[model samples]
Target chain A: MTPLPTWQRGMRGWWRRDPAFRRYLLREATSVAIGAYALMLLAGLGCLVAGPAAWQRWEGLILSPVGLLLQAVVFAAAVIHAVSWFRLMPLTIPPLGRPGRRLADGAIHAGAWAASALCSLGLLGWLVYGA
Target chain B: MTDPETILIEVLRWHPDTPEAPWWQSYEVPYRADATLLEALQTIKDDLDGTLTFRWSCRMAICGSCGCMVNGRPELSCHLLLRDLAPGPVRLEPLAHFPVIRDLVIDQQDFLDKLPAVGAYLVPAEETEAAAAAPAAPSRQTPAQMADYYQYAQCINCLLCYSACPQYGLKPDFLGPAALALMARHDADSRDHGQAGRRAARDADTGVWDCTLVGHCTEVCPQGVDPARAINRNKTASARDYVFDLLLPGRRR
Candidate 1:
């Protein structure tokens, strides 16, 4: 093949520069934290199956300083993941409005945020009161 | 109103014939409130440096030819005013994620190759036409159907979305935003009946599956065409089809 005289640029530290790309990288990385959390939950389940002492040991490990910090990081990652997911929610579905008057982007964003807040609050209430 | 002042424009320069790699060339151009980056380049070509090369036609955003990197962001040079970017200097470069052919001009052959794979044009249904009625009759469509793909149809094939897409940057095979949006546009149209033929493009490893929904495509769009929405919505469809094909085999089809 004849060599074409064209310059191709490489992608390095792209996320480091643009906020949009940075957020996208964060959103992608949230899955690793989420996966780690799942593994921890599975380990907890295994401990419960082993006996009360094992369960207690697992629980202690989870609630420890390091564990708590890890949990906090995971929680933050999950929140970021969820917010990003909901932001794309409107786009996945058809627009919710008439022809000339379409749903505003502000409305879509607000709706997603509102729904997220309501669900989060409900979950908190359930944890505090019911569970 | 302020007096017109000369502002420095640092443009990335390169040529095939030269042994040297790409470098920046700065030109001082007289700036005005209404003048755009396109006009600045035009000024550079007309008065200052005649060697400056870039592709542009129809100074309006409608042409979609003047997309370039303005200070590390994909923007229509025709649409972005110099006054809004007022300062001593502004950086100009070819659109990212593509091969640079020359100063301020990137290769679009990859995008052109990908567009045909997605079946961007309308494929009409087999005509029964209610016992061979009027051939010239307009295809009637509901407002709701029009709303489905109208935004996607606004795409001018600018390839700014390609520049903005990190996924496309990483993997060149990935059918970038504009092509996928065009695919969705045709699929969503009431007159079109070519979704089945276009499934390979939609479900390929380099298709909608590649999009991470970074949404920079939507952000950088000169027209409000949301390629992220079209790509993501089809992800759901492609995933559903995958599941159905696995479980039901030929039943789903």
Candidate 2:
């Protein structure tokens, strides 16, 4: 006769308990902030298509403290998303596979960060300084 | 020699014959500076509790048989010195994400099934080439070519990476780290022509696509085999294959 197997229950608290798992959970949660920002932009676009009455209401919502707080949260999540995404680029697309064309992880990370900074700065400049 | 100093060890206990469910059993083990954790278990089995059970063979990291959870991390019991985990009350359990066969032993059938699923073995490019070549002649491999897949080849199949992977805990069918790393190891090998055959396992939703690049597997590996690196690197390869498959369905090289 065979002995019955005894199974141990796994904890759902791994995200809260483990430091590595917590970081992974936080990285995944950034998508919520991105989705929130996308919805906000879509609302603004909808208001524009609906003309002045709807546009005024959208403008009020955009200028509200709550709206500003949401934007701040979204911006913070985007920055984290960008940094973590760039950090993972070295692993996803490695540096040393090719002969005579080796690049360090740091170089890859910095290149990605710089590209992101340039794109962000250009977009900010266009938003504020464009006529 | 003076009477050996003792330390407490808490090992998870379970038996099919016993009515009680799994529970921790603590033992006061005589400490020795040079003794590995496996030695402590041996002492417990020999002197203290003969009923206590765990698996170990090589008494070294090479066999990959002595893997268990120490302080919530997967490590080979034979590889860790008891002196390092001193000050009493070291917690021991079966490897995470695997069903316990008994005390510190886990049923490794899940891992065994995945090995063949991913085409873990190398497939020679030509069956006739082997017949034509001299029996004693060595297959040509430059130092550079050897280095490409050398790191991944060091995997001891300890399932330490599986225990470290949260993705495996969540989705058992994800073809977790060791198997995927082995897949990438053979895929990267210049001599192996098994990449095309392993494509189904690699390209599936449960393949490299499931890994979110947590990288804990690499950190916990006793042999320093970076399965996270292999999984993520293959993500790039998988993406390329996806694009190519779409562009030229029948023209894949």
Candidate 3:
């Protein structure tokens, strides 16, 4: 006897598979980068709580090849985050009015870079001073 | 005397009866000086091929009837002048996130169903005998309060935000941006005391939790309702309820 053929469907259930799944992927990737950054800081905190020997061990790990490579990856992720965050900043605020209109798109991008630079310098100064 | 411009319009055409599924059809149409994208589609339909199907009403942006992907961006065809979009060719497709009914027309039932689930109406509190007997005072609205929900109220239920929304794309039942804006309008109202409706929207997995703060809804919205901000504000409300609202007396209600 001949077996019946399985029916092929045209469109799958939209909720199961849809266009927004791509955005969820972006969020997951960004979150992984953020998690990595968090763990790096927590590692420093762990070293501090431990004895000097333990702290040296942490420092050695920081200087090690694997640690350096991880740091490089983190930095690259951070750059991606920085660009994405800047691109999205326009959505947070209302249209910048007539004066903002005068400034070109490149200028808007430059302004975000300037703000990030100021923030990084401020944070570095505070960390170094406290250290 | 006018120079002719060639626009390669990429169109997604589908026929349910056809053995072959939906395919992109390219049409090279001469661009008129002040022609909107709608005009080009009309040109293709009127002269080139009668099989070309699309949905449109009011030829203007008011009806919210003619929403489609204009060059991979969600826009009202009547509003998108071809001169501004003059880069060789333009892409046209049905709005993303919803199932295409046929060609540019998408199945808008999901968005419509969510409207009722969010309680898209004013729910007045219980009218006591004394309260009912009392003279009904006219509800006066200030310019600022009107300003708050006016843009939101102006939503024509166009699925443009749905197209822009990644959350609605992933989770069809998420109620999306426009519905959330409607909920926010009622929740913010001084008269409407529909906490239950707010709770319902706040409690779904696909409802509010699925949103990962991707503010694309606000970005591609022709009308600036800012549904992302509405959802964020309600997240604070939901968190507040979770922590200490029950502890306080009649505060949450």
Candidate 4:
């Protein structure tokens, strides 16, 4: 006797299949913007090392409409990445707090957001006053 | 609004003997407010069509045998009431990422084979010669200790997680969610000493690494067993083990 045909519903458009999958894909896709921003920063550092004239040229390009637009997109992506990362952080790590008492997931998220806010404010203060 | 007295349940049907492909065959199941999808299926099987086949054991969700795709999402048929999906067509299909055996029944041979492969059971701690000679005693655990793995222990091997997992659909070789969660369940048990033996399976490429944390496994789970969390926690453990194995090979646990 011949073997029966087992129906295989392949993973076609898997990301679109479920809301969770779509969110996962969106979170993963934000890395492209983050990586692009990192590369731009690296290039700016190279320009600074080259000469003052090169540095000025790089600065001008960064202050351009396209550059500002790209930066805005990257910033949005970074915010999304950071939030999603923090939300998932508790899951990846072992249960926090003492043996009997474990930290709530909300506490982890709040702690992460607080830390991020503190760092951002510190960076902003340094840029405005220290510089 | 459709007729309130009856609900249409569209079942994906397949047969080995037939030349036709798997197709949607709708049944008008007499709907009651409290009737579950399992009851509706039973109605179809008992009165409407005897050929319509699906797996169900405990009418409650404990058996985990009644899992199927209800309206494209993996769900326990016994748990979903007809009142919730009222007055319309409810599409039922075999769980995704599994080979269809018949109508609403999937071949769970792969998942069944993976259970022991991950060492989802406990291995007692090595006993001293004197202890070994004595009569065996129960290795007790405190409430706190039990809490560590109690959530994972609730897993009914429903296969809904596997159905919800796109990674399992894409890469069938991936150990998938429920089995990995079971592995974590045993690993977290205070009485279980099987972590060292189960390390190889957990550290493999197709192990915890394959999960991109889509997290639908946790969502679709009727038992509230967070397989995504279990797999990710093991990812951290596996990463630590990797570093330890590299830096101090002999000292690696």
Candidate 5:
């Protein structure tokens, strides 16, 4: 049997370094970050339930450089995750319109933006008005 | 006198066992204005590397056999040319959302299974009724009616939609674009009377509900099947049935 050329052996590297694989990595990384962020939120909730003092301590921890940095990283990952997920929104979700007349891509983005805005506003309301 | 053009193809490949199972493999080949991407791959395989493997037949895109990822999009290799892709490099890989069978090949067994689940083939209304046939009835159609489902009928079972589907990538069991589009084709046809088939096939996980309507499948279809529309329309049908369960009477249990 003829042996594979010296370069063909290297071409076999494609199995590991393909773009789909890289995209999968990016998608999964953001997902894992989001999961970790959720855990942090849950822990904060636990601290709040424990006592006011505990909630203050948790708030102080969140304010520290390391926690803020981690939060910033998760925020960035969340953005990446959003973009990837939205770009793929047309697939799993229902189509926004008729066959030939598809709804604008902006509408999908607008929906996401609206959801984010509502969440932000609610958070602000909780901190300012409710508290 | 003229200088010849060249197109570089970078293919992603992988083996199941290798820890570093996936990587990019490049091929530089002479370009021609009329050459299809599949033709380039064929040339590479024939002259350059026999180890390079992909499936092809009826090279004119009718067979729907030669589809893969072309520049991060699902496309028929036989229909796309390097000249259209342009100056330097065009990426080539197996279809997205499938396990690699080899270089530009994908595992299609799961995709095929959904076709059967949908009852894709025509089930003759009368198995033996030659005498009862409508005697040379005139074919009736207005242009507007044809326009409604025309583009969708042109699908040739190319798995490009499967590649474009993210749902299938994550859940291999998802009854994806082509099968659902094929189902929609039958359902859309005024002639078909396969009500039982649609009910059985349209489920929550593998059926119409599984689709998130990303619309990517429709965009990348070489035949312009508009699978997203078909899927959503069927999903609407399913949703309506779910809401009006009492009025619908029976069929789904």
Candidate 6:
């Protein structure tokens, strides 16, 4: 008997096929911006170590329009990354709370967001008042 | 608006004997507000085209036999009402990422083969000879223990998750969603002592690590089984295991 040919529908642009796929791609893409921000921070540290003059030069460049725009994009990506990460946090961990009474997913999200907000505010306050 | 009395269902048709590639064949099925897509397929098979092939059983969404692609989304045919997809053409095709057996039927042998590898069933703890000889009492579980695995137990083996998974489409070697979810189901069971044995499968390259958490599997699931969560949680477990194995080689389980 001849072997019947089964139609193999290849995955061509499968990531673009669905909204869920697009969202997953977006979540994964956030890491690129986060990586760029980390590199920028490292570069700043390098500038600081070099000299005050080098530090001033780096600061000026960062405060420029293009740099500010890049920072804004990075900030947006970071926010997206954080939110998506927190949303998926509950799934990665074991059921919270005492046995027979697990914490709701909302509780985890709330806790995560609260912690993030507090940290962001603390950093802002320290930069404004102490720095 | 187009005639509400009848709606066109565009079905992808193919046969191995025919040399022609798979093509769309439209059937104008009588519209019914309450009728399901399965019923419409039945109408086409019974009255319109007897040659039109598909699979269906226990039409109320149980038995998991009637899953197919509806409007490019993996869905249970019996669960979708014709009214919701009213006024025009609704595309019907075999589930994505699978080889079409015929019109609406895709070969599920791949998924079926992965089931046992993931250890989808409970593995009873080893018992003493005395205990084995004695009458086996039913394993009782607390509400908390049951809750750990209850949601995962709702999986009906519908294969919609496979269809929704782009990773599975791109790489067939990956264990995919439903199987991994089933692995999680058993791993979470209080009575199951098979976690160690199943760990290798879940910890492999083709395991939970393969999933990008697209989460369409959960969305497309008729039973609400979150395969993404199941697979992702296992990734955490696998990572922890990897760290432990690396740090304490002697204590590796």
List TM-score per model, in order. Answer: 0.89, 0.88, 0.77, 0.94, 0.62, 0.94
Higher-DockQ candidate of 1 and 3: 1
Write candidate 1's Cα lDDT for A1-81 as tens digits: 775688888899777647889888889899999999999999999999999999999999999999999999999999999
What are the C-alpha RMSDs, in order, of all predicted structures? 2.8, 3.3, 6.9, 2.0, 7.5, 2.1
Flag regions of model 6 displaced more than 4 Å: A1-4, B1-3, B129-135
Tell me the tens digit of each residue's lDDT in model 3 across B211-244: 6667767777777777776666567666767677
Model 3 residue runs over 4 Å out of place are A1-28, A44-54, A64-69, A72-131, B1-3, B128-130, B245-253
Candidate 5 regions exceeding 4 Å error are A1-131, B1-5, B14-23, B123-145, B248-253
lDDT of 5 by residue, B25-86 (tens): 88888888888888898999888877777889999989998988777677888898667876
Candidate 4 residue runs with Cα over 4 Å from true position: A1-5, B1-3, B129-135
Tens digits of per-residue lDDT for model 5 on A1-131? 65222111222333243455456567768989999999989999999999999999999999999999999999999989988877655544554566456576678777877887899899999999999
* Error of model 3, residue B174, in angstroms: 1.1
Return the top candidate by TM-score. Answer: 4
Candidate numbers sorted by DockQ from highest down? 6, 4, 1, 2, 3, 5
Local accuracy of candidate 6 as per-residue lDDT tens digits, B11-105: 98988777368889999999989999999999999999999999999999988999988888999999999989997699988999999878888
CA lDDT, candidate 4, residue B7: 94
Give DockQ for candidates 1 onward, in order: 0.56, 0.43, 0.11, 0.66, 0.06, 0.67
Q: lDDT by residue for model 4 over B32-133, one digit each (tens)?
A: 998899999999999999999999999999999999998889999999999999876999889988988777888898998888889988898787786587
Rank order by lDDT, top first?
4, 6, 1, 2, 5, 3
Which of the predicted structures, 1 or 2, would earn the higher DockQ when compared with the native? Answer: 1
Question: Which 10 consecutive residues of model 4 chain A have the lowest summed lDDT?
Answer: A1-10
Task: Report how far off residue B4 is in candidate 6 (Å).
Answer: 0.7
Give the higher-lDDT candidate: 2 or 5: 2
Summing lDDT over every window of 10 consecutive residues in candidate 5 chain A, give the lowest-scoring window.
A3-12
Model 1 lDDT at residue B168: 92
Q: What value does the lDDT take at residue B153 in candidate 2?
A: 96
Error of 1 at B143 (Å): 3.0
